[model samples]
Target: MLILSLGRAGDMNRNMLMALVAIAPLCGCQTSNQADYMQIGYGPSFDVAHAQCEMQKGSVDQGYIAIGSPGFVAGAGIGNALGNLAAEDQYMKNCLILSGWKRAPHGQGAAAASAVAAGTPPTPYGIQRAPGSWINTALLDWSDANNKCVAGDKAACGTRAKLGARLRAAGVNPAPV
Candidate 1:
Protein backbone atom coordinates (compact mmCIF):
# COMPACT_ATOMS: atom_id res chain seq x y z
CA MET A 1 0.00 0.00 0.00
CA LEU A 2 1.28 3.43 -0.88
CA ILE A 3 0.44 6.24 1.54
CA LEU A 4 0.68 9.94 0.60
CA SER A 5 0.47 12.73 3.22
CA LEU A 6 0.06 16.38 2.29
CA GLY A 7 2.72 18.32 4.06
CA ARG A 8 2.06 21.62 5.93
CA ALA A 9 -1.63 22.13 6.77
CA GLY A 10 -0.81 25.80 7.42
CA ASP A 11 -0.21 26.30 3.70
CA MET A 12 -3.70 24.95 2.93
CA ASN A 13 -5.23 27.29 5.50
CA ARG A 14 -3.42 30.29 4.03
CA ASN A 15 -4.56 29.42 0.52
CA MET A 16 -8.17 29.09 1.69
CA LEU A 17 -7.99 32.46 3.39
CA MET A 18 -6.64 34.08 0.25
CA ALA A 19 -9.39 32.57 -1.86
CA LEU A 20 -12.02 33.94 0.53
CA VAL A 21 -10.45 37.38 0.39
CA ALA A 22 -10.54 37.36 -3.39
CA ILE A 23 -14.26 36.50 -3.44
CA ALA A 24 -15.23 38.70 -0.50
CA PRO A 25 -16.75 41.35 -2.72
CA LEU A 26 -19.06 38.84 -4.38
CA CYS A 27 -20.86 37.80 -1.20
CA GLY A 28 -23.99 39.73 -0.19
CA CYS A 29 -23.14 42.65 -2.44
CA GLN A 30 -26.73 43.49 -3.36
CA THR A 31 -27.32 47.24 -3.04
CA SER A 32 -30.87 48.36 -2.29
CA ASN A 33 -32.73 51.61 -1.59
CA GLN A 34 -34.51 50.71 1.60
CA ALA A 35 -37.65 52.73 2.37
CA ASP A 36 -41.14 52.61 3.78
CA TYR A 37 -44.23 52.46 1.53
CA MET A 38 -47.89 53.09 2.21
CA GLN A 39 -51.22 52.69 0.46
CA ILE A 40 -54.78 53.80 1.14
CA GLY A 41 -57.46 51.25 0.47
CA TYR A 42 -60.42 50.06 2.44
CA GLY A 43 -60.10 46.56 0.98
CA PRO A 44 -56.43 46.20 0.03
CA SER A 45 -53.77 47.45 2.41
CA PHE A 46 -50.08 47.78 1.70
CA ASP A 47 -49.52 44.11 2.46
CA VAL A 48 -52.17 43.05 0.01
CA ALA A 49 -50.83 45.35 -2.64
CA HIS A 50 -47.34 43.96 -2.10
CA ALA A 51 -48.52 40.40 -2.41
CA GLN A 52 -50.40 41.16 -5.58
CA CYS A 53 -47.32 42.73 -7.08
CA GLU A 54 -45.22 39.75 -6.17
CA MET A 55 -47.71 37.37 -7.69
CA GLN A 56 -47.45 39.08 -11.05
CA LYS A 57 -43.72 38.41 -11.33
CA GLY A 58 -41.65 35.27 -10.98
CA SER A 59 -39.85 34.72 -7.72
CA VAL A 60 -36.58 36.68 -7.30
CA ASP A 61 -34.85 33.67 -5.74
CA GLN A 62 -35.91 31.51 -8.67
CA GLY A 63 -34.24 33.92 -11.05
CA TYR A 64 -31.11 33.88 -8.89
CA ILE A 65 -30.79 30.13 -9.21
CA ALA A 66 -31.40 30.13 -12.94
CA ILE A 67 -28.98 32.95 -13.67
CA GLY A 68 -26.46 32.00 -11.01
CA SER A 69 -25.80 28.56 -12.46
CA PRO A 70 -24.39 29.91 -15.72
CA GLY A 71 -22.93 32.92 -13.94
CA PHE A 72 -20.92 30.73 -11.58
CA VAL A 73 -19.35 28.92 -14.53
CA ALA A 74 -18.38 32.39 -15.83
CA GLY A 75 -17.15 33.49 -12.38
CA ALA A 76 -19.93 36.07 -11.95
CA GLY A 77 -22.61 34.28 -9.96
CA ILE A 78 -22.96 36.89 -7.26
CA GLY A 79 -23.06 39.73 -9.76
CA ASN A 80 -25.74 37.97 -11.73
CA ALA A 81 -27.74 37.36 -8.58
CA LEU A 82 -27.59 41.05 -7.73
CA GLY A 83 -28.71 42.01 -11.21
CA ASN A 84 -31.60 39.58 -11.07
CA LEU A 85 -32.73 40.84 -7.68
CA ALA A 86 -32.48 44.45 -8.84
CA ALA A 87 -34.62 43.75 -11.86
CA GLU A 88 -37.21 42.02 -9.72
CA ASP A 89 -37.18 44.96 -7.34
CA GLN A 90 -37.77 47.43 -10.12
CA TYR A 91 -40.63 45.38 -11.42
CA MET A 92 -42.16 45.16 -7.98
CA LYS A 93 -41.88 48.91 -7.53
CA ASN A 94 -43.62 49.57 -10.82
CA CYS A 95 -46.36 47.15 -9.95
CA LEU A 96 -46.93 48.72 -6.57
CA ILE A 97 -47.14 52.16 -8.11
CA LEU A 98 -49.73 50.94 -10.53
CA SER A 99 -51.57 49.42 -7.59
CA GLY A 100 -51.66 52.83 -5.84
CA TRP A 101 -48.97 52.23 -3.27
CA LYS A 102 -46.60 55.12 -2.77
CA ARG A 103 -43.26 55.39 -1.00
CA ALA A 104 -43.67 56.93 2.44
CA PRO A 105 -41.68 59.99 3.47
CA HIS A 106 -40.45 58.35 6.67
CA GLY A 107 -37.02 56.76 6.79
CA GLN A 108 -36.57 53.01 6.91
CA GLY A 109 -33.56 52.71 9.23
CA ALA A 110 -35.55 52.32 12.44
CA ALA A 111 -38.00 49.90 10.85
CA ALA A 112 -35.25 47.83 9.29
CA ALA A 113 -33.41 47.65 12.60
CA SER A 114 -36.57 46.60 14.38
CA ALA A 115 -37.32 43.98 11.77
CA VAL A 116 -33.78 42.62 11.96
CA ALA A 117 -33.95 42.45 15.72
CA ALA A 118 -37.17 40.46 15.39
CA GLY A 119 -35.41 37.91 13.14
CA THR A 120 -37.22 38.86 9.94
CA PRO A 121 -35.55 38.31 6.59
CA PRO A 122 -32.94 40.89 5.70
CA THR A 123 -33.80 43.45 3.00
CA PRO A 124 -32.47 42.24 -0.34
CA TYR A 125 -34.10 44.45 -2.97
CA GLY A 126 -37.58 43.09 -2.47
CA ILE A 127 -40.82 43.71 -0.63
CA GLN A 128 -39.96 43.49 3.04
CA ARG A 129 -42.45 44.42 5.75
CA ALA A 130 -41.43 46.15 8.94
CA PRO A 131 -42.24 44.22 12.06
CA GLY A 132 -44.80 45.64 14.52
CA SER A 133 -45.32 48.79 12.48
CA TRP A 134 -48.51 49.76 10.71
CA ILE A 135 -48.55 51.91 7.62
CA ASN A 136 -50.72 54.96 8.17
CA THR A 137 -52.00 56.25 4.86
CA ALA A 138 -52.95 59.54 6.47
CA LEU A 139 -49.33 59.90 7.55
CA LEU A 140 -48.24 59.69 3.94
CA ASP A 141 -50.83 62.26 2.82
CA TRP A 142 -49.79 64.50 5.68
CA SER A 143 -46.15 64.25 4.64
CA ASP A 144 -46.96 65.29 1.09
CA ALA A 145 -49.14 68.10 2.30
CA ASN A 146 -46.42 69.22 4.69
CA ASN A 147 -43.90 69.38 1.87
CA LYS A 148 -46.25 71.39 -0.30
CA CYS A 149 -47.16 73.70 2.55
CA VAL A 150 -43.51 74.33 3.22
CA ALA A 151 -43.05 75.17 -0.44
CA GLY A 152 -45.49 78.11 -0.03
CA ASP A 153 -48.56 76.31 -1.34
CA LYS A 154 -51.36 77.87 0.74
CA ALA A 155 -53.89 75.24 -0.35
CA ALA A 156 -51.64 72.49 1.02
CA CYS A 157 -51.76 73.97 4.54
CA GLY A 158 -55.49 73.29 4.71
CA THR A 159 -54.95 69.78 3.30
CA ARG A 160 -52.28 69.12 5.90
CA ALA A 161 -54.68 70.03 8.70
CA LYS A 162 -57.30 67.63 7.35
CA LEU A 163 -54.85 64.78 7.08
CA GLY A 164 -53.30 65.51 10.48
CA ALA A 165 -56.72 65.43 12.07
CA ARG A 166 -57.34 61.97 10.64
CA LEU A 167 -54.03 60.79 12.13
CA ARG A 168 -54.91 62.31 15.48
CA ALA A 169 -58.25 60.49 15.48
CA ALA A 170 -56.36 57.25 15.10
CA GLY A 171 -54.16 58.11 18.09
CA VAL A 172 -51.13 58.76 15.84
CA ASN A 173 -49.45 62.06 16.46
CA PRO A 174 -48.25 63.51 13.21
CA ALA A 175 -44.87 65.09 13.70
CA PRO A 176 -44.37 68.79 13.09
CA VAL A 177 -44.11 68.71 9.34
Candidate 2:
Protein backbone atom coordinates (compact mmCIF):
# COMPACT_ATOMS: atom_id res chain seq x y z
CA MET A 1 0.00 0.00 0.00
CA LEU A 2 2.81 2.44 0.91
CA ILE A 3 4.65 1.76 -2.34
CA LEU A 4 1.46 2.26 -4.35
CA SER A 5 0.78 5.58 -2.56
CA LEU A 6 4.33 6.80 -3.28
CA GLY A 7 3.95 5.92 -6.94
CA ARG A 8 0.66 7.83 -7.10
CA ALA A 9 2.23 10.88 -5.44
CA GLY A 10 5.07 10.86 -7.98
CA ASP A 11 2.60 10.59 -10.86
CA MET A 12 0.51 13.46 -9.47
CA ASN A 13 3.59 15.68 -9.13
CA ARG A 14 4.55 14.88 -12.71
CA ASN A 15 1.06 15.78 -13.92
CA MET A 16 1.11 19.07 -11.98
CA LEU A 17 4.49 19.96 -13.50
CA MET A 18 3.22 19.20 -16.98
CA ALA A 19 0.11 21.29 -16.42
CA LEU A 20 2.24 24.22 -15.22
CA VAL A 21 4.55 24.00 -18.25
CA ALA A 22 1.58 23.88 -20.61
CA ILE A 23 0.15 27.09 -19.15
CA ALA A 24 3.52 28.83 -18.65
CA PRO A 25 3.24 30.72 -21.92
CA LEU A 26 -0.17 32.07 -21.02
CA CYS A 27 1.14 33.37 -17.64
CA GLY A 28 4.07 35.31 -19.10
CA CYS A 29 2.85 38.61 -17.68
CA GLN A 30 4.13 39.20 -14.16
CA THR A 31 1.92 40.39 -11.33
CA SER A 32 2.36 44.08 -10.54
CA ASN A 33 2.29 45.84 -7.15
CA GLN A 34 0.87 48.91 -8.83
CA ALA A 35 -2.81 48.80 -7.94
CA ASP A 36 -5.52 51.26 -8.99
CA TYR A 37 -5.94 52.50 -5.44
CA MET A 38 -4.41 55.92 -4.88
CA GLN A 39 -4.36 58.76 -2.40
CA ILE A 40 -3.90 62.18 -3.99
CA GLY A 41 -0.63 64.01 -3.23
CA TYR A 42 0.36 61.25 -0.80
CA GLY A 43 3.46 60.36 -2.78
CA PRO A 44 5.90 59.23 -0.04
CA SER A 45 3.14 58.59 2.47
CA PHE A 46 1.28 56.48 -0.06
CA ASP A 47 4.38 54.41 -0.64
CA VAL A 48 4.75 53.90 3.12
CA ALA A 49 1.13 52.79 3.56
CA HIS A 50 1.36 50.45 0.58
CA ALA A 51 4.46 48.82 2.01
CA GLN A 52 2.79 48.39 5.39
CA CYS A 53 -0.28 46.78 3.85
CA GLU A 54 1.87 44.44 1.82
CA MET A 55 3.81 43.44 4.94
CA GLN A 56 0.64 42.78 6.93
CA LYS A 57 -1.07 40.81 4.16
CA GLY A 58 2.09 39.02 2.98
CA SER A 59 2.13 36.89 -0.16
CA VAL A 60 -0.21 34.02 -0.96
CA ASP A 61 1.09 31.07 -2.94
CA GLN A 62 -1.67 29.29 -4.78
CA GLY A 63 -0.65 25.79 -5.77
CA TYR A 64 -2.15 23.57 -8.44
CA ILE A 65 -3.23 20.23 -7.01
CA ALA A 66 -3.41 17.14 -9.20
CA ILE A 67 -5.34 14.13 -7.94
CA GLY A 68 -5.85 11.34 -10.47
CA SER A 69 -3.97 10.51 -13.69
CA PRO A 70 -2.87 13.38 -15.97
CA GLY A 71 -5.45 12.34 -18.60
CA PHE A 72 -8.29 12.41 -16.04
CA VAL A 73 -7.28 15.72 -14.42
CA ALA A 74 -8.83 18.66 -16.21
CA GLY A 75 -7.81 22.31 -15.57
CA ALA A 76 -9.69 22.36 -12.27
CA GLY A 77 -6.58 23.37 -10.34
CA ILE A 78 -5.94 26.34 -12.63
CA GLY A 79 -9.50 27.54 -12.14
CA ASN A 80 -9.15 27.18 -8.39
CA ALA A 81 -5.91 29.16 -8.45
CA LEU A 82 -7.56 31.92 -10.43
CA GLY A 83 -10.38 32.08 -7.90
CA ASN A 84 -7.83 32.30 -5.09
CA LEU A 85 -6.10 35.17 -6.91
CA ALA A 86 -9.37 37.07 -6.99
CA ALA A 87 -9.82 36.54 -3.27
CA GLU A 88 -6.25 37.63 -2.61
CA ASP A 89 -6.85 40.79 -4.60
CA GLN A 90 -9.87 41.54 -2.47
CA TYR A 91 -7.86 41.02 0.70
CA MET A 92 -5.20 43.44 -0.53
CA LYS A 93 -7.84 46.02 -1.32
CA ASN A 94 -9.37 45.68 2.11
CA CYS A 95 -5.96 46.03 3.71
CA LEU A 96 -5.29 49.18 1.71
CA ILE A 97 -8.62 50.72 2.71
CA LEU A 98 -8.05 49.81 6.33
CA SER A 99 -4.65 51.46 6.05
CA GLY A 100 -6.41 54.68 4.93
CA TRP A 101 -6.15 54.67 1.12
CA LYS A 102 -8.75 55.66 -1.44
CA ARG A 103 -9.23 54.51 -5.01
CA ALA A 104 -8.30 56.90 -7.78
CA PRO A 105 -11.11 58.18 -9.97
CA HIS A 106 -11.67 56.47 -13.30
CA GLY A 107 -9.39 57.79 -16.08
CA GLN A 108 -7.48 59.92 -13.57
CA GLY A 109 -3.87 58.90 -13.63
CA ALA A 110 -1.56 58.92 -10.57
CA ALA A 111 0.45 61.79 -11.97
CA ALA A 112 -2.68 63.90 -12.37
CA ALA A 113 -3.88 62.99 -8.92
CA SER A 114 -0.56 63.85 -7.32
CA ALA A 115 -0.60 67.23 -9.04
CA VAL A 116 -3.74 68.12 -7.11
CA ALA A 117 -3.84 69.09 -3.43
CA ALA A 118 -2.99 66.46 -0.84
CA GLY A 119 -6.01 64.46 0.25
CA THR A 120 -4.59 62.50 3.14
CA PRO A 121 -7.41 60.88 5.03
CA PRO A 122 -7.73 60.72 8.79
CA THR A 123 -5.58 58.20 10.60
CA PRO A 124 -7.13 54.75 10.66
CA TYR A 125 -8.29 52.84 13.74
CA GLY A 126 -5.07 51.75 15.46
CA ILE A 127 -2.68 54.24 13.89
CA GLN A 128 -1.69 57.65 15.23
CA ARG A 129 -0.58 60.65 13.25
CA ALA A 130 3.00 61.64 14.00
CA PRO A 131 5.01 64.60 12.87
CA GLY A 132 4.70 64.43 9.06
CA SER A 133 3.71 60.75 9.11
CA TRP A 134 1.39 58.15 10.61
CA ILE A 135 2.51 55.42 12.97
CA ASN A 136 0.99 52.22 14.33
CA THR A 137 0.68 53.47 17.89
CA ALA A 138 -1.33 50.57 19.22
CA LEU A 139 1.17 48.05 17.91
CA LEU A 140 4.05 49.95 19.45
CA ASP A 141 2.37 50.20 22.84
CA TRP A 142 1.42 46.56 22.72
CA SER A 143 5.02 45.60 21.96
CA ASP A 144 6.31 47.62 24.87
CA ALA A 145 3.75 46.20 27.28
CA ASN A 146 4.34 42.71 26.00
CA ASN A 147 8.02 43.02 26.66
CA LYS A 148 7.41 44.24 30.20
CA CYS A 149 4.88 41.47 30.79
CA VAL A 150 7.43 38.89 29.71
CA ALA A 151 9.76 40.34 32.32
CA GLY A 152 7.27 39.58 35.14
CA ASP A 153 5.54 42.97 35.26
CA LYS A 154 1.94 42.23 36.23
CA ALA A 155 0.73 45.77 35.51
CA ALA A 156 2.33 45.62 32.09
CA CYS A 157 0.45 42.42 31.36
CA GLY A 158 -2.83 44.15 32.24
CA THR A 159 -1.87 47.08 30.05
CA ARG A 160 -1.14 44.76 27.16
CA ALA A 161 -4.51 43.05 27.68
CA LYS A 162 -6.34 46.38 27.66
CA LEU A 163 -4.54 47.50 24.51
CA GLY A 164 -5.39 44.23 22.77
CA ALA A 165 -9.06 44.54 23.72
CA ARG A 166 -9.17 48.18 22.62
CA LEU A 167 -7.64 47.31 19.26
CA ARG A 168 -10.17 44.50 18.80
CA ALA A 169 -12.97 46.90 19.64
CA ALA A 170 -11.66 49.25 16.96
CA GLY A 171 -11.75 46.38 14.42
CA VAL A 172 -7.99 45.93 14.48
CA ASN A 173 -6.72 42.42 15.02
CA PRO A 174 -3.55 42.53 17.08
CA ALA A 175 -1.39 39.54 16.46
CA PRO A 176 0.48 37.82 19.25
CA VAL A 177 3.64 39.68 20.23
Model 2, span 1-177: residue lDDT tens = 011122366776786687788667646432423344454232345567677765655365455554554434635655655566566667667766665565645554344344433653423321332223122567667767897898999999999999888888877877763
lDDT of 1 by residue, 1-177 (tens): 112224355754564465556567755553323246544222344567778877875655443222222223223433454566677778887877676555555675446535645876333322443323343446656876898899999999999998887778878889863
lDDT, candidate 2, residue 164? Answer: 88
List TM-score per model, in order.
0.35, 0.42
Give the TM-score (vs. native) of candidate 2: 0.42
RMSD (Å) of each candidate, 1 decimal: 14.3, 15.0
- Tell me the RMSD of model 1 versus the true structure: 14.3
